[model samples]
Target: MLGIKVELIDKIGMHSSDTAMIFLEDVKVPASHIIGEEGMGFTYQMLQFQEERLWAGAAAVVPFYKIIRDTAEYCGQRKAFGQPVLSNQSVYFRLAELATEVELLRSLLHKATAQYCMGHNVTKMASMVKLKAGRLAREIPDACLQYWGGMGFTSDVLVSRFYRDFRILSIGGGADEVMLSIIAKEMNILPSKKK
Candidate 1:
């Protein structure tokens, strides 16, 4: 704890969950405090990231579903052109698509969890889940916010809050590019490096 300085980073998203930049200035950590064996930190962290990816993917399912429902409800009550905005073919159809996408992600997350519980390695499955979840986190909110119209841009609405919050899914656990690389490596499609 000594020589450690913590500063909260002011981020556009994830306001409730505070993110910080930690500075370690010549901190002395006892060997007993070290996690696992010496020189295995990288291995340990990599192993932890698999679980993190799965969690980030699975956790997003219900929240986005709620967002979709709420946005739909709002649109149904709100009128445009003398009819409910949701009555438009474009609005409801897109909402259906977003809902369906979340369902698919939920299925994938459940399958990955089952395999994980059975003591199977799920790096590929987790990566897939994470990648899809990250994309949807972006897509679903953006679409829903558009339906919210000017209100979506404001901080008052839940859609706006989620827009800020969930944007981290793609960048937090692993960037989309990193997830793709992991999937590619697992698929045997990534080119081998020249030795």
Candidate 2:
């Protein structure tokens, strides 16, 4: 499922632009194109982030599952002291835990999307999903690659590639701290006192 690139001339996937605006842009294009109902661009952009973030989370799910599988295969084949590396429970279960985390993140993303589509306010949900996905993207492949020892450091292994590639999820979708701040603002958790 991963590494399959589609040939579509769509800017949404290219520059992380939202599909909603792309459609809107197509219908109404002018030399001076300022979008939304005057000062509502912030709200619209937040909504767009929800969709883009959910798509990002969905894109990561399958590749993460495959990481566990590939790691298991590597452990099974790799030997140390004439015993298969997978004979160690820690190696296998750590990855199982990572897979569980990946699934949990996916569940949150799906739930957020469903709620948003049902006309519920999903700002908090979106922030949560983006935050978790960012943290997971950093930790999962990093931890999985560590399981491979020296091979994880080499370009020959897919784990190495995953390690190199998955780092962008946090910074690209929105930095992890940015999501936290947004969620806090949504929940009125940010400190404020009347002057």
Candidate 3:
């Protein structure tokens, strides 16, 4: 090995996964391992971030859909006050609203993906998608979890796990605030730098 050491950082939510803290103290990297121009590392990483954020946004869509769908199904089967929980207008309406949000996010992701494939810069759109996805990832699951009642609070339920795990979406990547800042800059709404 090239003298690389990694330690696992115990995370609260993604307990089933590994988050590593890699240490490369005094580690020498050969020039052959360098990517692109020597002074362009930051530029390359920023370019790659466009793709990574898009992927993170797209990846969140499916699980959000499934959580909503499964919660709806559960509501249909679970009885409350001698009627299916899904029979209530509030329940179904909220589910419908959440579904709409998911669809909107999916459409944006698709549009960004298409534009990116065509050699267009998708920084603004991708940031929008990531921001929306992060917000919905928190919103949809929490709403669905409420329908599950006490069961949703328990660790055994998948929705509960998702509730915990989805929190990272907003904080990870570039964060919701960071995404907003990027979008603002792209839209020329940010104040010009003062010299």
lDDT against the true structure, per candidate, is 0.93, 0.78, 0.91
Worst 10 residues of 3 by lDDT: 1-10
Model 1, residue pairs in steric clash: none
Model 2, 1-195: lDDT tens per residue? 243333435432223433332222225346378765777978887668878777778778888888889988998999988998988888878988898998898889889889988988887887787778778877888888877889898879877776766777787758888888888999889878689
Sort by TM-score, top down from the best: 1, 3, 2
lDDT of 3 by residue, 42-133 (tens): 88888887898899888899998899999999999999899999999999999999999999999999999999999999999999998998
The 10-residue segment with the lowest total lDDT in model 2: 17-26
The C-alpha stretches of model 3 lying farther than 4 A from their native spots are 1-3
TM-score of each: 0.95, 0.75, 0.92
RMSD (CA, Å), candidate 1 to true, equals 1.3
lDDT (Cα) of model 1: 0.93
Question: Which parts of model 2 have CA positions greater than 4 angstroms off?
Answer: 1-44, 193-195
Alpha-carbon shift of residue 96 in model 2 (angstroms): 1.6
- Evaluation by lDDT, superior candidate among 2 and 3: 3
Candidate 3: residue 71 lDDT (0-100): 97
